[model samples]
Target: MGQRLGVDVIYTGPSTADASEQVRILEDMISRGVSAIAVAPNDAAAVTPVLIKARNAGIAVLDWDTPADESVVDYSVQQVDSTVYARHMYDLLVQNMGESGDYAVVTGGLSAENLNIWIDEGLEYAKVKYPGLTLVTQRIPSDEKQQLAYQKTLDLLKAYPNLKGILGYSTPAPIGVAQAVQEKGLQSRIAVVGVALPTDSGPYLEDGSLDVATLWDPGKLGALTVYVASELLNGRAIADGQDVPGVGRITVRGKVIVMGPPSDFTKENYKDYTF
Candidate 1:
């Protein structure tokens, strides 16, 4: 897609959520004469200087999925907001858990801003609305491991014997937590919810170990990001509530793109989704 748009995409491979690495990738991509760069920033603040340099070099820089620096970025595209998604996740968990019980949250990485935002939003939402719901623990797995999430859930269950629900921030986190609940023979008491791919979560849901997971249309997110980048490259001033071609209608609020609603997955409708 970058090549089709006359831009070369320099994939920096799978690196840690480190800012220096992000900067290095941007510098390398820019030095190669890439007219525009779309980045999924690992560290939001660490990559700011290099992104600033790329902007100064007349290269358009856009942040996709995660925003590095709103001031320096021409635009930031997201599939959904953390708070909105978190509220939805919390509501589902609370409703399933009878809206009052001990709960815990498992996260992908402590330093990943995007995941952290979702965790924060979910935690805050739970605290405000479900005052009786106590947070048993907040665990962030090393290397984004499902096994680690499982272990953390087990530990939380033992430490807080009243734990009734578990909320995860990413695809793997929830799946891992559900697997742990099943293994510990606590699935009957504990409910699991998070952002998980439907195919990967189908078995868990079928077994009644998981309740709800959120999914988004990646094709739509990618297409919209590409379209918005093209428009910004053409020197169009983006305003709030502008429509992008393939992504649907979007509104720009602050640094976020606000790409509309997220799709939910449950046992009743899980078969209808594949990704």
Candidate 2:
């Protein structure tokens, strides 16, 4: 996508979700005088000042996936409305669980702003919409690691033997939970729903371990981010309902960009999406 737009997008960050490393990376980008910097902050507050520094250096600062402080950030390219998406996860959970039963949440961690938004919204939405649903414990942090999530799911099963549904909030969380369920032959006993890539979540979906995995295309998101940044750099407005190729049409809200709807990958449709 960056190549198509003639934009040299340099993708680099801390390998281990480190905030200090993120700051160091941005500082280097600032030193190199890059035209734009798109960050999915590991820590929004920890990364905000550096983003502001980039902005003051006459570089475009955009946040993708996770958001940065809105006051200084130029644009937030989001995949979908967090509230709606969160509720949709619960909706999937309810459908798979049949009657409401004990369920729990496994998240990437407490740091990411986007994860918090989804979890908070989902928890509140679940209380009102599915009154029969019961959350067994506080949302557990998986540290965005599949092995950790798998370990956590095992613990969840031990803690709540009657657990009927599991809502995984991170890309790896559901896969990890699904693995544990699959190994335990609990597919029929437990319904797992989570945010994961189609390619990564396909096997679990096929085996009925993961009931549904939901997410938007990262390829399209990257393209849209570069496209938006390019427009701003070239002094063009990002019009509402703008048709962004590969990402479909987008809706602009002030400094925010919504990249159409999210895709829910089930066993039947998982093969339809390549990325």
Candidate 3:
């Protein structure tokens, strides 16, 4: 999309999980005088000022995957509505766990606004729709690391032997949860579900450790981000239900662009996808 739009796309990210580094990178991008900037923030609050600076400099700022401060970015590109995605995840967990049991959430981190939104929505939906199900613990932070999530899941299992389900909000979290369940020989007793890359979760899905996973196409999201940035740069207004190439018709609400539907991957079809 960048090539088609005759724009140079410069992609960069922090080498580690440092929001300061991410801020530095964005500041550098701003210095480069780019036409636009698209980012998935590590720390939404910390990056807001830099994003605001970019916007002030006449750069189109777009948020994707996870949103930064709404006041800084022109719009956000989301995989799906947070409420809908959360309910879908919760429904899948409840279905696999026989609709009633103790469950816990494993998130990327407490600072991830998008993950927190999903967890909050899932909790709310569970309270109303699945009253028999109980959330046994508060959100467990995984730090977006598989090893940490594995250790955390182990601790949760040891703390609550009767834990029946785990809802993971990050890709690494679910895979780690599945590993812990498998290691404990609790696959038959516990169910794990989350947003995971099929390539990462395929083996677990096949072995019955991970019951299901859901995600949208990241490639399409990247292309769509560039397309939207180009549109904004060219002074084009984004209308609701506008058809975006590569991504289907999108819904514009406030400053957010709902990308499209998310797909569920199970053992039966996970093999068909590589990313």
Candidate 4:
């Protein structure tokens, strides 16, 4: 996608346990003449200085999926704003749960800013819109393994016998949660919803184990970053509402650019989407 957009992209790779190694790798990408870079920083704040150095070297920086220091990056592209996605998830859960039930949230990690913001938004909306609903627990399972999410779901089920809904933000958690629900024969009693790929959650949706999965074309987002970086490198200013060729039209509000809608994949429309 980057090459198609006429820009060269270099991966800074995943964040490591060692902060110095992370910085060294990013600086090396800049030294190698990478004009523009896009990254989903594992540590939101820790990657800021390297991005700052890149900016000092006249490189255009773009942050995606994960946020970086706003002052260091030229722009940030995300699937959607945290609060917007959260409310969307809340609405879906309410629709499936009939507006009232004991619910639980499965998040990526408690320390991850993006996941926490989404959870906060969901909590606020649920409090205001579904006062009858009670959130029994919010689980942050070890996102590294699929089994952790499955095990966490089982623990949640045992802890909250009245649980009627689950909203998961992690990629694997929703799928594993669905499996646990099906195994426990609680599919009819509890509904699940979250961000997931269609293929990953297809069987569950088809069998009515999972309610819905919110998604968007991630490759499109990556492609957009490259195109935008190319535009920046060419010294063209992108106005708030300017339309990019492959990224659809965009509207910049504050520091965040809304990429597109949360493509809700379910039994009805799952087959229509390829990604």
Tens digit of per-residue lDDT, candidate 2, span 87-204: 8988889999965789999999689899999988988988888889989999999888999999989989998999999999879899999999998899999999999999999889
What local distance difference test score does each model get? 0.77, 0.90, 0.89, 0.79
Candidates in order, TM-scores: namely 0.88, 0.97, 0.97, 0.91
What would the per-residue lDDT of candidate 1 be over residues 212-264, giving only the tens digit for each residue? 88878776787777767776777776667877666678878766787888998
**lDDT score at residue 23, model 3, on the 0-100 scale:** 94
For candidate 1, the clash count comes to 0
What are the per-residue Cα lDDT tens digits for candidate 3 across 74-114?
Answer: 88988789889989999899889978889999988788889
* Model 4: lowest-lDDT 10 consecutive positions: 11-20
Top of the candidates by lDDT: 2
lDDT of 4 by residue, 123-156 (tens): 8888898898888864565453457778988999
Instruction: Give residue 19's lDDT in candidate 2 (0 to 100).
Output: 85
Off by over 4 Å in 1: 1-12, 15-20, 238-243
Order the candidates by lDDT, highest first — what do you get? Answer: 2, 3, 4, 1
- Superposed model 3: Cα runs more than 4 Å off: none
Q: What's model 4's lDDT at 127?
A: 89
